[model samples]
Target: MALVFRPDKKSIEKTLAALKSYGNLVAPDARFNYDAKDGLRKEVCFRDEDFLSLLSSIDDEYVVDSILEMLKGKALVPPDAFYSKDAFDKLVALTKEKWYYPWTSFTKAMRRLFYMLASIKQPRIVVGMGIFYGYTLAWSAGPSCGKDKLYNAERVYGVDINTEAIEGARKNFAILEGSDHVELIAEDGRLVAQRLEGPVVFLHLDADGEKIGKKLYLELLKILYPKLAKGAWVLAHDVTDPGFQKQGVFTEYLNYVRDPKYFSESILFDIDQCGLELSIK
Candidate 1:
């Protein structure tokens, strides 16, 4: 459950060696310093290109390990450790495959985080607001396919505006060998919300950014808010970035969730630059 990296010299050396072997990259130098109040301060500087190249070549496990090694420090532990090893391993494999989307896609950490949330929530319905090549859809629904069936959902719905993206998502879902639980719909978020029945326990809001994305998300929430179960969880992507925060892109939506009348708790996970807002209703 220890999510913080807090790497020692040995751990850092091991990670660097792994990166070199996996990506043919090398760490130029490392600085280790200490402050009276903060204790050990460790910094490792490497080429950004090299790191990205390494990420491109390696598998999800290696990527996750490297991320943990690099970001070692005092941090909130992820809930993934609570799940069975088999379930976690399945999630890792599911995320390893390539999922193409026109814009930026979800990272290994983000996918893993989704799996953790799904395992914990075990919702009867899993809804993804933006399908986009079905990567998030697969991540949202994959855990439910486990032997123990971590998610007891009868259906998983993926809604997207782009017809081409929906087509691509269908192919992606097919590649995933999705069962009867999967449902891919090309429609507006409001319509998707209208069609949904029963309490939605897990909701993933990963639509595009800016005015369009903001409007779609707001519309969906307006319709679906009453349908959320008491302990339902919502994951809103791209809301944590400082740039978007300054622009007030999704501030209205976030403010609504932050209000005690709607949600019981909300937390921001600052992973990579892709900020995720986790709210419990």
Candidate 2:
């Protein structure tokens, strides 16, 4: 497809520079083509715009790449950057109430990362599918900030394979001292496909590999498409390009989702080694 934005003499260089930034996008080698001839070269990356058009288009990939590029060359900050003293106090209070955060790593790293990202976007509801004792991130973000918020909807509502994890998440939520609106549930995220609702934001921490990720990804789209308000995003974890040392499930799903006709955009991130921040249009 022709890029949405055409290049002129004044903008050709700028457009080329933007394409160069996506040099690391992973795909079948044949997906992109490059040639050098007569002291001239051309590189075709993913189907994107003439760099100038990207500045104006709302393509999901465009937004994701822009955000990732903005994040690059920048150091991550502590949770304090996003959480206020009161919010922190509430989180700690809830944790203490329920004997939560027994693990220092969750408090120090996971929760901190969640809050920092949340502070930037501040979605009303951040849902984590198939949560296994990992609600601290959502709790630390505080309640009443969003229209809908839940942790481990499947586990909370009594879904199978999540009983153990749900028990732990419940204890963690208890520590928050009855900030009960976080809406812990125990229903399968797959079931979400038929239950259309309002604009919802989600975080899929559910561990899935190639086939599983693909299944979950499609199921999630079925459930969330009609429900999502314009501009909603999904943050999926564990996606990476580890030099293709082995058959990686996360890598496969990342590739599948980046298809422009399906999921429009993605932002590669190095959170805990590797991850992709996705924005579905």
Candidate 3:
């Protein structure tokens, strides 16, 4: 495939440098970071009070739309597939109402993209690694669950290392109707991926490794590669979540997925402050 939306390393580098130079995305005063009390991995990350407000801001939606078009252009998305905004919005509302985030940089566009992935792919098995509070997993499997479910799915699993977070996720998912198909487990992500049954169609990677958080994305992909379906899509989050500050972890990841030897195609989208790398196998 001739990818029109491949990773833009230079632009990402620039954005990272600017962010580091200016710093502190949560406030105008530049007072916090990923390590702050309510920063990156806290019980609650700083974000818009509600998802409706976040989705309402569509000024940069063209960025996500361009990516959707790219997926369609490259035939990654089915020609007959479509996702309803009303459905997606409802999913967002339900998630915001029922779920809690330990920490995330998830943006409106990113959530929409993940939800759309489910609507289009209609995967039988969906797996999420390092799903902090299950929201990421919920988004990836949105169309398969909930009252507005777009399709029926066989199984959806979310793996996290934090037992407490997984406990919270279980309770949250239990409250949401039609989410019985979704399972939350607290274990090593790599171990769970290796033990998975077969042919996972949609994989969401947000697992933080021993060293750099997102560096583990590559390892997860490598392990899951053989188990991936023919047209599987791997969504790696935080590909540029201050990656420039982490010494080329994401760069190596970008290179691996972009290379035709491993993946048929790869594209990097930085719609939100964070980046999501989409790869097809």
TM-score to true structure, per model = 0.67, 0.53, 0.76
Clash totals, every prediction: 4, 16, 0
lDDT of each: 0.68, 0.46, 0.76
* Local accuracy of candidate 3 as per-residue lDDT tens digits, 1-281: 77567346677556666766764333343332334452343333333334233432564355556666877887777666677678887877877876777666677778887877778889899999998888777777788877788889999999999899899889878877798889898998989988887789889888887675677888888898999998788888876655443466687888889999988988877555566788888
Summarize candidate 2's per-residue lDDT along 139-210 as a digit string, tens digits: 334533332332222211212135566677666555554345555555566664356355665444443323
Superposition error at 258 for model 2 (Å): 2.5
Q: What is the model-wide C-alpha lDDT for candidate 2?
A: 0.46
Most lDDT-accurate candidate: 3
Better of 1 and 2 by TM-score: 1
Top TM-score model: 3
- Candidate 3 worst ten-residue window by lDDT: 43-52
Clash pairs of candidate 3? Answer: none
